[model samples]
Target chain A: MDEFELIRRYFAPLSGAHEDVVLGIGDDCALLAPPAGHELAVTSDTLIAGRHFPEESLPFDIGWKSLAVNLSDLAAMGARARWFTLALALPEADERWLAGFADGLKALADEAEVSLVGGDTTRGPLTITITALGVVPAGCALRRSGARVGDRVCVSGTLGDAALALERWRAGDRDRSDDALDLRARLDRPTPRLALGEALRGLAHAAIDLSDGLAADLSHLLRASGVGAHIYGARLPSSAAFDRLAPAAERTRLQLAGGDDYELCLCIPAARLSEVRRLAQQIGVALTDIGEIQAGSGLSVLGAQCEPLAFTELGYRHFQ
Target chain B: MDEFELIRRYFAPLSGAHEDVVLGIGDDCALLAPPAGHELAVTSDTLIAGRHFPEESLPFDIGWKSLAVNLSDLAAMGARARWFTLALALPEADERWLAGFADGLKALADEAEVSLVGGDTTRGPLTITITALGVVPAGCALRRSGARVGDRVCVSGTLGDAALALERWRAGDRDRSDDALDLRARLDRPTPRLALGEALRGLAHAAIDLSDGLAADLSHLLRASGVGAHIYGARLPSSAAFDRLAPAAERTRLQLAGGDDYELCLCIPAARLSEVRRLAQQIGVALTDIGEIQAGSGLSVLGAQCEPLAFTELGYRHFQ
Candidate 1:
């Protein structure tokens, strides 16, 4: 069978039926009707085999992370996940890998209540491109340009675990301690803060998903909003796994410059902090206050003593 | 500079502002509000370096055709093009290539009246994946499943020129005959039948864009409609260039199985033939009646002498 037929048999079934999806896999284009009065939030992310993840990463993990990162983008915008399309290129047609990949994708998609509407599969180097679509009420989209000076900077869940996991794996640490396993899971299947984002719609002024470390991503938010930020390093939440796995200095570096943590970093007004905290608690996601948006230019990272901290690198650079 | 910085300098300008687009390039996701009472049609197509096109193909043409194929899918659905996102992977950051590629992409996008929304670029083997979004009135979408037996099969413009062009190019024909250049143009920059498709909205029962060769693509339409088709070789439209450059037998073969034509293959009711023809004339697209849909299963190709034509290959198969 050809690659097209393989996709029809294995991957097409993963495009779950939805009322909004008028046409699905069998057509030249998939038809979808976004709910009335809602703006569609669209994002695309491409993951290459060796650069984005280790070449030896499991197919299931790769599939999960590919969708996870795209979903994280939608989550950052406080949009409700709706539909997505995938463009996957592979070296060869392997049935077992395809099945595992589809399973991993479907599991996360089902959790987010999103459906696969369309996709294209081709033969080439292994790469996956996913375009995810979501919906938000018109004019209610949370944007990076809305952060105001004096807003409390917050992040959901812990940081540094995914990068820590990669560091350990690269160092040939095969002992799989509980912390190691936990960190590895974070690297493989980072959770998107969809519910928390949806809950923070009006309360948060601006938000961004942490894909390129807190230092860099927050700087993006600050730049867009034309403000500055003061990040209290001591308050940047790190998982217990991170603390157990690395030294304090290394842990601080990971929290500041590590990538692949798909958590939402938000800027909320000081007046709404109590309500935002209540919403986070109701949603069952940890919301930690890590910094404050300030009136100035550039970002300032503070140590435990409220003194400026210096770092050689702020985030992962793709072409550096 | 990094890949992200490169995108900021080169591609950010290509993202023209559209009022419906609440947010464009520099955000976590692009926000768009589709006109009320319209359903969105989304399609994705990926072009790999050597697999989809020649390894030596101009970066500009690669960018144009990558978007063109996705637009063709939208055209086939009779949807009005709206927005698109690109996920581009490259072997290295070459500024000249990026500028030329952006120029080709922007040229087509301007003609289609679609705005670039969001995208991701990374380092890898060269590949371009484009997801185009369009809008159609609710429940007015043209679909492959709507064809019925006794429907007349029709096509827009010409067929087989692209495949014939590829054959000649492979045979080392470098001297540019008018026919060679015409066929080469057809292969490189085939126009999407957007106007004709939109005009056929209520007139055509079913439709599909020709990407895979006619024989294979027609089979897809038949399978979706639970019917069959008989394509008359004599009626299939061939360009003047195709007739001049290829042998009669070779022309017949290419017409049957050549891919990348990017024309609209549609099914219209026999009773509405005159009205459809008038609409085609008004739209300035040459619509040719090729055959008819039958009540049985499978497809049959008949020659000028009413004899069945046999073929060794059906169309381009990805994994063959």
Candidate 2:
């Protein structure tokens, strides 16, 4: 099928009628009315085949992960997901692949209550780029530069599960244990903490979604806020699977430097710690205290006795 | 350089402080406050190296055209440019190429008064995807489905110059004439008619930007509007270079089916023709009455005697 036919058959139905979306797909541009008294939280992300995921990855998972990553950015900003545009580059228009991909994308979009507003499809190397737009009450967006020296650093959900799954998959460790299967699922489909993020809007001082591991991503938050972080290595949260399967040193490595965890790393004021915990509990997501913002300008992970621990790797970088 | 370093060095400087931009790069998401009472016109476009442009094309031109094509979509919707996000996937981060690309992108962005808000940089095949968001007055977006019978089908500026340039360049015709150089320049930098599109806003019944040739793109507008058009094949505009160098038949072929024109195809009520012409004059963009919307469906290209002409190709289609 040609570009237009592919769009009409596979992509068009993905767009749903929404009150804010004045015009959706099949337009020169999607016309959307931003809710009054709201600021748009916009983020863009691209996933490339073989580079981002396994070459044999299911199209459904690719579609889910593409939009999920961008939504994670919105979540980090404490924005409510509203709309997204997909710019898809594929080697060819494979009907089966497109069908599965659309299904995967629509499933998450439906859950997020976000509409597929507009997009472009072209023929090239398989690359899926999604630009997600969300809305937050004006002046209420959680920024990375908002963290104070005394703020308590926290993260929602488990860390390094997705990266561990990727490592195992790459090593061809086909252990079909429940933990293995769960890790693979985590790698394939990350859950964006939209509800938890929105819940933390007023309470959290600073936030960032973990993509390039806690070390690198949190370092960014620290640099942006001009503060340091003293992370308690033992307090780093992990799934039961992670705890059971990973060796001690490997677990520490993955937890600190393994990337692709879609969990939100946040800094909350000391006074708001209880409120933030209650909120995360109400939202049904695990929130863990990982570190504290400090007055200095570097990151240090503390050992069991509060001594500095040496870290070998920070995180993944695109071009190193 | 790593992804974050590359962004900080090359892309961050592209972002200018704008009143509407609550937060720019360095955050999880860019915070933007859309103008009050204005609806956002959002569009996304992807340019894959060797697919969208010649692999050897200058990074400058690649960047310019990448954002320019997306702006063309916004222009077609009659929106004023505002903010855009760039999602770039490169095999490696070449400093010189990134600098040139940023320069090219900044040149056009500055002219359009749009700000670079945020983006993603990932390791992959060279691919650039931009999601541009513009704004138009509420209830005033020019849409593709608004055409009615008897509306004058108009197009801004010239067509086929870029396509002809590509044809000649592919043939390795190294002609040094001014026309040859102009054609090549056109291919490299097809200007998006933002001013003309904004001028045609309320006066035009329907609009579309020409990317896939006049024949195919206009057919899309026709299909969307549920109307047909009797296009004067000879009236398809051509640059001085095209008139001087292109053979008659080749000219017609290129004008009809040449993709990459970035010009606006508009449907204006016959009564508003004079105003549109005057406005085009004011905007310093050529406006040509190429056809008239008629009852029924499917586009028709007419000869000098008003007889229907047979055109073999419609336009370029990926995976065709």
Candidate 3:
């Protein structure tokens, strides 16, 4: 089938309707009305086959992960996702693959209540680029530069499971234990902390989504805020699966430096800690206070004995 | 350099500050505040190496064309360009290529008054995807499905030069005559008719950008509007360069079916014809009336003597 037919059949149906979407799909452009008093938050992520994902990965998973990563970025800003556009490059039009990809994308999109607006499909190596747009109250959007010296740095949900899962997968460990399966699920279908992000809008001073591991991503917040951080190694949250599979040191390393964890690392004012915890509970997500912002530069990790821990790797470097 | 550093060095500086962009590069997501009572128009385009452009085409040309095509989409929607994001996939980070690409992209973006918001850069086969966001007055944006039966079909600027140039290039014709060089420039840097589009916002009934040639793209407008078109073969605009380089029939074919012209195809009511011309003059762009929308469901082309003209190829097809 031709490109037009391929898009009409596989991608068009995925563009569900929304009131804010004045025009969706099948136009030179999609028209959207950003809600009054709200600002539009936009972020894009591109996932290339064999680079961003395994070549053998299911198309469905690839589609889900592609959009999920963009949503994580929006979630970092405490924005409510409203619309998205997907530009896809495929080596060839495979009907089954397209169907699976559309299904996977639509599922997450529906859950997020975000409409697929306009996009372009072209011929090339398999690559998916998704630009997600969200809305947040004017002046209330979370930013990385808002952290204060006394703010408590926190994270939502467990970390290191995805990295640990990738490690096991690369090592060809076929252990299908419940913990292993859970870790694999975390790696494949990461749930963006959208609700928790929205809840922390007024409570958190600064926030960033964890894509480049806790150490590196948190360092960005600190750098942007012109502050430092002291993360307690003993307080780092890890999935039960990660703890069970990895030795203590490896688990700590993954928690600190492994990537692809779509959790939120936030800095909440010390006075708002209880409120943040209450909101996290209300949103049904775990919130862990792993560290605190301090008056210096760079990040320091304190062990159980309160000694600074040295990490060999900071995070995943895309071009390294 | 790593992806983050590469983006900071090469792409970040291209993100000029704009009043509407509350947050731009380096944020988790760029926050935009569209003008009050204005709707956002969004479009995306992807250009792949070899498929979209010649493998040896200058990086600057590729970058310009990539964003230019997306701007053309916004122009078709009668939107004022505002913001854009670039997702680039490169085989490797070459400084010279990146510099050229950024320069090309920044030139057009600055001319269009659009700021670079946020995007992704990755390691992969060479590919560039640009998502552009524009703004239009509420209830005034042009759409593909608004054409009326009696509306006069019109186009901005000339057509066929790009296609003719591509044909000559493919045939190994490296003619350096003034006309040949002009055609080559047209093919490489076709200007997007943004000002004309804004001027036609309230005057045009329907609009579309000619990326897939006049016949195919106009047919999309016709199909979406549930109408037909009667285009005069002799009235179709062709640059002097195209006329000098192509034979009569081939020239007509290129004018009708050539892709990548990056011009605006619009449908204006018969009564508003003079207004459109006046607006076009004000915008300093040539406006050509080539046909009229009809009540039927297919397109028809009449030769100089009003006799029906038949053509084999309709336009470029990605699958083909």
Docking verdict class for candidate 1: high
Q: What is the lDDT of residue B126 in candidate 2?
A: 89
Measured with DockQ on alpha carbons, how good is candidate 3? 0.90
Candidate 2, residues B1-320, lDDT tens digits: the string is 77768888888888987899999988999999998899999999888887788888889999899989999999999999899999998888889999999998998888888999999898888888999999999999999999999999999989999999888878888797999989877887778888887887889999999998888888888889999999998898899999998877687788988889999999999999998899999889999999899999988888899988765453434312
TM-score (second chain) of model 3: 0.96
Q: How many collisions between residues are there in candidate 3?
A: 0
TM-score of every model versus the real structure: 0.97, 0.96, 0.97
- Regions of candidate 3 where Cα sits further than 4 Å from its true position: A313-320, B313-320
lDDT of each: 0.88, 0.89, 0.89
Q: Give the best candidate by DockQ.
A: 1
Question: Model 2 Cα displacement at A157 (Å)?
Answer: 1.2
Tens digits of lDDT, candidate 1, A71-139: 999999999998999999988888888888888898898899888988889888899999999999999
- The CAPRI-style docking tier of model 3 reads high
Clashing residue pairs in candidate 2 are: none
The per-model DockQ list reads 0.92, 0.86, 0.90
